[model samples]
Target: MSDMTAMELDEASGQAPRPLRERLSLGPFSDEWTAADWIVGSASVLLAIASAGFFGWSFVVSMKSPDYFQQAALANMPPKLDRIETGSIDVANAMPVPQIVRLSEPTPADYQIVMVFNNEALLATRNELMRVKVGSIVPGLGLVRTIDTEAGSPTVVAENATLHGAPATR
Candidate 1:
């Protein structure tokens, strides 16, 4: 075995010898990532989530209450009832209908009315008023409330704590 130190080997190879402490030095170039890097990365992630949440929430809220869709349905209604002369009803006059019901057959005094705005409704029969309730008609909207007996007598449950397409604020 040859007796030689690392310094001797380095010197023999015409290389500058490095001290043990200097060889073990931890400089910026040797670091994988700094505290500043972590802080900036975390901030970037937070900002992305915040921006997405802000826009996503806005879209969800708008979809929940689509006034334009409800308004369009009501606008197509006839100006008069059964050929009877009736003046033009304002948009406000037309009640928004989130749901509609059709009865099996038409009977005397058989009419449907809104019950609790989303749970049940009063269906007038010959003997008594029938309470008809159904599952959640609108997904986000809760249980049935309004009953449009003109069509199927199925009760409509909606969310928003009001009749589907109730009344416009303006």
Candidate 2:
């Protein structure tokens, strides 16, 4: 074995020996804090105390004059009614009656249904049937169908198709 000095051994071990005093440093500002650091810290403490005192004062004021606070809170609230009369004759008289008559069955000319696969085909169909008034759209089982009175025959489109442009599945 080669005779290695203490410093050489420490260097080989990836560590440098330090004196006790150097290793016992308190913290970053242990030596002495700057005047600016002291001023900023004092200001921060004072601001926190002032904010707490202001909140305490507000709480005391609110507790002393609870009625004032309550009035302030209720100032923008809706007025309380003495009694609520549901389905009353006066309410019925005030309401406007609809003139529409109920129909037993909807007419075929009222709506139409169109089926498409992807969003692009749906947009194209919508553009083509712009004049036709659509009622509602039902989407399920990987199929989308439109309900409208003036819609043409349903069309089915799929992303993956077999030979001759026919869908692979039924």
Candidate 3:
């Protein structure tokens, strides 16, 4: 019975150590390459050739200017000149004069309600902005209260503005 190490087995299999450059080269296949290696190499070479051909054709087409066939057809035509009599009415209809219309800006609109407290002072809003979902928030001068517009004027009762009169004395 004989015992063989890893290096001895490698040498016995007739497989030699390759250089780093050869191993890193375009050799994805092994030494004894199967049918798949040849097919892959051929396909890769064809793909590279097709890519280079497409780029070369594109560059050549872009470098040269196009000459249409219409230029050659027009060259065979003869040149002629004609004259018109004095005050000849050649047009069928005359064009009307154009007028420029100037547009003006529209004026802004505002709605508000004034509240007076105890006949001494009053609260009048200068600028009031109201939206659909978001209501308006205005500070009072002599009274502090919240105004809700759910129903008609009945919703805005006098009880809502109960904070009238002057400040409380201590």
Top candidate (TM-score): 2
Model 1: per-residue Cα lDDT over 56-132, one tens digit each: 98688679876865677789986557422565566776778675344444332243343433445544444345555
- Which residue runs does candidate 1 get wrong by more than 4 Å? 1-30, 67-170
Put down candidate 2 lDDT per residue, 48-149, tens digits, no spaces: 999999999889988898687778879979876644444335665576878634343222232233333332233222223422213223221122233221
- For candidate 2, list the clashing residue pairs, or say none: 110-149, 111-148, 111-149, 112-148, 112-149
- Decide which is better by lDDT, 1 or 3: 1
Given candidate 1, what's the lDDT at residue 122?
49
Clashing pairs counted in every model: 19, 5, 0
Candidates' C-alpha lDDT: 0.55, 0.46, 0.43
Model 1 shows how many backbone clashes?
A: 19
What TM-score would each prediction reach against the true structure?
0.22, 0.25, 0.22
Which ranges of candidate 3 are over 4 A from the true structure?
A: 1-31, 66-170
For candidate 1, what is the TM-score? Answer: 0.22
RMSD of each: 19.9, 22.7, 25.7
